[model samples]
Target: MDFGFGPEDEELRGRARAWLTEHLAGPYADIRGLGGPGSEHEAVAPRRAWERELGRGGWIGQGWEAEGYGNRRLSLTGQVVWAEEYAALRAPARVGHIGENLLAPTLIAYGSPEQRDRFLPAIARGEELWCQGYSEPGAGSDLAGVRTAAVREPRGGAAGLLRVTGQKIWTSLAREADWCFVLARTEAGSRRHRGLSFLLVRMDQPGRVEVRPIRQMSGTSEFNEVFFDGAVAEEVVGGEGNGWTVAMGLLALERGVSTLVQQIGFAAELERVLASYAASHTAPGAEDAVLRDRLVQQWAQLRTMRWNALRTLGASPDPGAPSVAKLLWGGWHRRLGELAVAVRGAAASAGPADWAPGTPYENGLDEAQRLFLFTRADTIYGGSDEIQRNIIAERVLGLPKESR
Candidate 1:
């Protein structure tokens, strides 16, 4: 398949690069590389403002097909070009990515017209932010093991609400999110994936909801533990008891364009590692032939990943594609993190002392240390390596189910 871009795509790339360059100036210039993955706690206020800037420029939700919902209808190639340019420009990490890339598309695909009208506009405006409430305490990888329950509470003046009560673990951007799209067990005696409902819950409802940031070894609180106690959700997406279907559909949409967009950021990280290697004069592996070979391999593998992702775009619906992509990038990133630290030799083993006088301990991890520690959970958090292999075996290869 020809992966070459046409003149139109080049023009779109130019426009996106220009817009990003023009906006990432003045006060916003300091936050150009802030807020991503483990570093999400950095420059929160500026990043939030950046979201609104993106909204004004009509840069959010370029892939959505609905009229008047997005700024303009962009082809898949155009979307890729825009994503590449945005990452290349070192734009502040998007606070609206979950809403724009995940929830909005799911809503457009399965939500009611009322739901779409109410939600899409707010998301497009970047006025509202969203977090996913899928992973529960016991259901990190096995989504079907979700036990967060929601019960209908009939109201006198309105169509009843679903009262949710459970704890969600490792929720990204939960504290900053204005809303959360949750999957909860709505039917009594439901097993596994059945009898679940996708409910939209307000995150700031006083005592009903709580978000506690989970501090990582990287010393950043990007993930959170969100507790829902009698929380209310009036919007049950795709109807109650149909959540398994809706949730699975949303998972399918999570791949494709989003995965490719992620690779652009990965490329930036790779470039940083290479720069570090070049700057080090006396580092242990600076001249090691084997380490040098691995460095070259990392570049080659990233290129291969980009091509693989491009080939998978708009391809036939393969049940295993998302899992495969996850498996590939998860391992690749973790290895890159290791290479990042290894290239610095023994100096990477010890971190700096805590600069703050009142801090608890002396250990202070820099960006490379943080990257090494954070990527350790990449394969574990999303879906475990075991889970991805199981998916490929049973669904794609037609192998027998594992004994559970």
Candidate 2:
């Protein structure tokens, strides 16, 4: 496959590099504040600020159509360049990820005029934040097994609320979210995939809702466990019993564009790690050599991932492509952490005090250690590595599905 960018792509990359080099400066480079492990709790101001910055610069949601972008759209290559440059600058993760990656496209595909008007512009400008309420305790990976019920209200507008009741686990950024795109059963006694509906819910109001952050290895609830014991659902889009498609669509977004950008950011973190390691080269040994070699391979892998994503974007949004990218990143990140642990040696015991650039700042080392510790589950979340293998085998290679 010719993974090379065309002339226009090259030009776009150059412009993106120049823009980031100029704009990404001063206070943004600290790495931790942009939703990394050590960020302080801000109500919603941080997300708003970052969104406004990206929106003002026309950098958020690169794939937004011309009409969506006031009569012009970013080319696919341009978006790839933006992802690269954004990561290169260590800009905060787009706080509007749920809006940008998950909901916006779905709305474009299926949302009614009111839904579009209500949600799109705000997401584009980062005015309102969103979260996904997808995974349930019983259906984390077994998506079809979702038991969250969204019963249709009787004698009411179909625009009527779907009484949503179920738990959503691993909900990222639940605490400050303004809205949720949730999946639940609508028709009783329907099959697993049938009767499911995708509902948009406003989290601000309450009707039997609970949210408790689930602590990660980072020692923070970067994600949350959300429970709804008869929470009200906002307007339902994509209709009842067709939620499987919308939910799958959302997962498709996660696997594709968003996954690609996240990998780029993680690669940047690896770059930071290498820079620190190179600066701190001492007590030369074979272990160091091995780690360096692995780091070099990782750099190559990240580039490969970018090129793969570019190719996918240039063509169609293939579901398999994102899973492959996610699988690759899942392993690569863990390796970075593992090598960092070896690099840190005893200093990891003391935590962040051990990871100071090349000098082994205690904090950097501590963070690296945490990254390593946490990355083990990387392969399991989203969809497990095994599940991805099954997808690639059956769908890509035309092999039979694995027998349950």
Kindly report which residue stretches of model 1 are placed more than 4 angstroms away from their true locations once superposed. Answer: 154-159, 281-286, 354-363
lDDT per residue (tens digit) for residues 76-97 in model 1: 8998898888888888898888
Clash count per candidate = 0, 14
TM-score of 2: 0.86
**Clashing residue pairs in candidate 1 (N, C-alpha, C atoms within 3 angstroms):** none
Worst 10 residues of 1 by lDDT: 354-363
- lDDT values, one for every candidate: 0.87, 0.72
Looking at model 2, report the run of 10 residues with the lowest lDDT sum: 354-363
The runs of at least 3 residues in candidate 2 whose Cα sits more than 4 Å from the true structure, single-residue gaps closed, are 1-33, 36-44, 69-72, 157-159, 283-287, 316-319, 349-365
TM-scores of all predicted structures: 0.95, 0.86
lDDT string for model 2 (1-404, tens) is 35555888777778877876765565443432356433323324655576766666666667754255331266655566667766766666556777887788888777787888778777777667888888888887777888888775676766555788889998877887888888888888887788888898888766567888886545555678888887888778887678888877777766656666777777767776887677678555634667778888888887787777667766765657866877787888777778776666677666553334444232243566667767777787887888788778988888987786
Model 1 Cα shift for residue 349 (angstroms): 0.7
In terms of lDDT, the best-performing candidate is 1
